[model samples]
Target: MKTRYTYGGDEHVYVEVDDEMSLDAFFIGLSLSRLVREANIPGVTEICPANASFEVRFDPDVIAPDEMMARIKELEGEAQAQEKRLDTRIIEIPVFYEDPWTHETLMRFRERHQDPSGTDLDYAARINGYDSVAAFIEAHHSQPWFVSMVGFVSGLPFLYQLVEREKQLEVPKYLRPRTDTPKLTVGYGGCFSCIYSVRGAGGYQMFGITPMPIFDPEQKISYLKDFMVFFRPGDIVKWKPIDRAEYDAITKQVEEGTYAPKIAEVEFDLDAFNKDMTGFNAKLMEALNDA
Candidate 1:
C-alpha cells in the first residue's frame, strides 16, 4: 500500500495508508507507526496511529522534515514486507444496556435524535433491522470490536467490529449535539461504536452505561497506573451485557478499589482474519476466554 504523506503545519507529519476504514488499513498504519516509534528519531515527539492513518509530531530543527519523511517512507516499505501481527490484549467491558442514567439522558435529547418518539436503542435497533432492542444488544455482543482509534476524549475508543462490511452496524448522529452525555455511556454512530470516557457534549446515540472507568486521571486503578486511559489503538474489546444486579455489584467494587478489568494478551493475525473471519475470531476469543 502506498502512503500519502502530508505536512501538518511545521511540526507534524500525517501519513494516510487507505481512503477507507478496514482492518487491513489499520494493520498497515499500526505497523508503520510501531516502527516509527521504535526508530526513536531525535526530533520525534509523539506517534499516533488512527483508523487508516497515523501522525507523527517532531521538531523540524533537530531532524529536517525532508530527512524524517525519507526515513518514514523507508519504514513504510519495511513494514509492508513484515508479517501483519500485533501484540495486543482483549478486554471484556461490562455494560448495562438501557440503563437508567443514559435512558434519562436520551429521553431528554429525543428532539435531537433521528426518531423523536423512540429511545436511542429502539431507534438504533429498528434502523439496524433488529426487531427489538434486546436482539440488537445480543447481536452487538456476538462479534468482537477492534479498537481502531482512541480519541475524541481521554479514553474514548472508536471500535470497528471484525465482520463483513455488509454485516456492520450503522447509525446516524443526532441532528443536534447533546449538551451533556453521561460518563461511561456506550454509543453508536456511523459504522463505529464508542464508549464516552467523560461527561461532555457528543452526537452519538447513547445506549447504555458501563460501571468500569476507562479514564482515571488520578490513576486510581492499578492497571491504569502508567496511563490514565486504558485503550490502545490496536486493542480488542468485547462488551459483556449485564443486569442491574451485576452492574451494581461492579460499581461497588470500583468504589472500593477492588475491581480490575479482565484482560488477556493475544497475537492478532491480519491475513488469517481476512481469509476466514469466523475462524480468526474464534481463535482470538479463545485466547481471552482460556486465560
Candidate 2:
C-alpha cells in the first residue's frame, strides 16, 4: 500500500521509502554513511525527506521497481508494527528567489564550502550520520531518487539531476555571471526554474525564497535537503511566491546567519552500524559556505 518504485537507469534506480526515520535522525543515522562506501553496486542513498515522502536512489537496472517499493512497504510495516515512529519528517528551510539577471547579487565572495558533516546543525538535529552518503542509504535511509546528484551549485545544496526531460523550469546562463559565480547558487537549467541555497545570477522568472537558510557553513548537517530542505527528487514542490519585503528580510537573515525557524525539531535514529569496505572522500570543500 506504500513505497512505490519509479523509473531509472543503469547509473541508478529511484526507490521511495515511506514512514521511515524522522526529519532529524537520518542525518546521522543513515544519510551520509552509504556514500562513504564506494565501489558497491545495488547501493542506496537518501535524496530527501519530505512530509510523507522519503527518497532512496539506486540503479534501476540493478533493483526492480517492485523490489524498491516492496522494501519501502516492508520498512513502514516494520516500524508501525513495533509502534516506533522513526524521527523522519519533512524539514522546513528558507529560500530566496531572485532574477537571473541580477548577477551583481549572485557571485560568491569566497570559495570552498565548509563540511557540514559534524557541527551544531548536524549535531543539534537528530540525523543519522555515517562515514559516507552511501552507507546511510543502505541502512536507515530510504526513498531512492535514481540518477540524482546530491550537490551544491552556486552556493546552494540540493539533490538534483541534469533534467533532460521537459524541465519543471527553463534554465539558461546567468545574464551576467560574476567573476565568481558560485557553484552552489544552483538553479534548474535554461531559465533557472528552481533556485536554492545561496544567491546567484539568474534570468529566469522564479518564485520567492522560503524563510530559512538553505546552507550553513559554521554548523554541521549543512545538506539541508533531508534535514532542512527535506526536498528530494520526484517530490512535487509547489512554490508559493512571497513579496519583495519578505524576500529581503528572509535572505538578509540567512546571509547573516541570524534567522530562526518556526518548526519543531524531529529526532529519529536507526541501524547505522552497517559498514562498507569501499570508501569515497570528497576533496571539494571548494564549495564555500559563507558565500
Candidate 3:
C-alpha cells in the first residue's frame, strides 16, 4: 500500500497508510508504527497509530523534518516487506446485552437517535438483517474483535470485528452527540465497537454495559494495577454475553478487588488469517479458553 506523508505542524509528521479503513490498512500502519518505536529514532517524542494512519511527534532541532520523514518511509518499506505478525493477547470481556443502564440512557436520548421508537439494539438488529436481538447478539460475540485503536477517551479501545468484509456489523453514530453515556457502556459505530472508559459525552450507539472497568485512575483493579489503562492497540477482545445475575456477581467481585479479566497470549499472522479466517480465529479462541 502506498503511504502519503505530510506535516502536521512543525513538530508532527503524519503518515496516511490508505485512503480508507481496512484490516489490511490498519495492520500495515501498525507494523510501521511498531518498527518506528523499535528503531527509537532520536528526537522522536510520540508515535500515535490510528486506524489507517500514524503520526510522529519530534523535535526538529534534533532531527530535521525531512530526515524524520525519510526514516519513517524507510520503516514503512521494511514493514511491507516483512511478514505481518503481532504478539497480542485475547481478553474475554463479559457484557450484559440490553442491560437496563444503557436501555435507560438510550431512551433518554431518543430524540437524537436514528430510530427512536425502538432501543439501539433493536434498530441495529433490524438494519443488520438479524431476525431478532438474540441473533444479533450471537453474531456479535461469535467472532473475536481486533483492537484497531485505543483512544476517544483514555484507555477506550476502538475495535474492528474479525470477520470478512461482508459479515462485519456496521452502525451509524447518533444523529447528535449525547450529553451523557454510562461508563463501561459497549458502543458501536461505523463497524467499530468501543467501551466508554468513563462517563461522558458520546455519539456511538449504545449496545450494553460491561461490568469490568477498562480504566481506573486509582489503579485498584489487579489487571490495571500496573497501568491505569488496560488495553493496547493490538489486543484481541472476545465478548461473552452474560445475564444480569452474572453481571452483578462480577460487579461485586470487582468492587471487592477480586476480578481479573480472562486473557491469553497469542501471536497473530496476517497472511495465515487472510487465507483461512475461520480456522485461525478458532485456534485463537481455543487458546483463550484453555487459558
**Candidate 2, run of 10 with poorest lDDT:** 277-286
Candidates arranged by lDDT, highest first:
3, 1, 2
Q: What is the C-alpha local distance difference test score of each model?
A: 0.89, 0.34, 0.93
* Residues 201-283, model 1: lDDT tens digits: 99999889999999999997766788999998879988899999999999999888888888889878888788999998888
How do the residues 1-291 of candidate 2 rate in per-residue lDDT, one tens digit apiece? Answer: 244445554433343433432222223212322332232325444344322233556655666656654554444433333322233222233333343323233323112212223321122122334454234222211221111223334233233211222322222333433344332232333312344555544332222235554455544343342454433322212233344677678667756656644332232222221121011001001111111
TM-score winner between candidates 1 and 2:
1
- Candidate achieving the largest lDDT: 3
List where candidate 2 sits over 4 angstroms from the true fold: 1-148, 153-155, 158-167, 173-178, 182-186, 190-211, 220-238, 251-291
Badly placed stretches (over 4 Å) of model 1 are 60-71
For candidate 3, the per-residue lDDT at 188 reads: 95
**Model 3 lDDT, full chain set:** 0.93
lDDT of 3 at 50: 90
**Greater-lDDT candidate between 1 and 3:** 3
